[model samples]
Target: MTVALMWEARAVAGKGEELLTWATHQPLDPPPLRRETFRAPEDRVLVITWWEGTYDTEGLPELPEPGEDLVRRAVHRWRFETVADGV
Candidate 1:
């Protein structure tokens, strides 16, 4: 069975681009990322990503800074399992 993970992240402060750059560099392994960017008012950045493959079952990848790594300020991430798309 193929699993797809849905991820969303909000950039802290106004460094949305910077945060995206860092995230793009993060290696999730196995399933690659298929992401989309959203721009909010006040320079806030939101990203929606979908990854398909067999993950570690841990849901998320291990990063140097899971909560507060290399970011400008705060970061919030939400993950979801893909149910049905383009079906």
Candidate 2:
């Protein structure tokens, strides 16, 4: 099964583009199979990465957090088992 890691952050006022730029450039160890990023109203950035492994396995690197100066609040993260893909 494929596991997906979701990360989200809200940038400080007027810094949404900077936040998105930072997220787009982040490097993942053992690179993920796929990654996508999104921006929402209110300076929120969301990143989702798909890996070819399960959550129980060892050696899964944790997602890195953005610099403290770039965000208004703490980053949020979640993991999920992909149930379906491509419609």
Q: Stretches of candidate 1 above 4 Å error?
A: 1-33, 53-56, 62-73
Whole-model lDDT, candidate 2? 0.87
**Which runs in model 2 stand beyond 4 Å of their true positions?**
85-87
Locate the minimum summed-lDDT window of 10 residues in model 2.
55-64
- Candidate 2 lDDT over 1-87, as tens digits, reads 898888999999999999999999888887888889999999999999888888655565556788888899889988888678799
Residue 75: error of model 1 in Å? 0.8
Error of 1 at 14 (Å): 6.1
lDDT of each: 0.52, 0.87
- For each candidate in turn, the TM-score is 0.47, 0.88
Pairs of residues at least 3 apart in sequence or in different chains that clash in candidate 1: none
| lDDT, residue 13, model 1 | 64
| Highest lDDT scorer | 2
Worst 10 residues of 1 by lDDT: 61-70
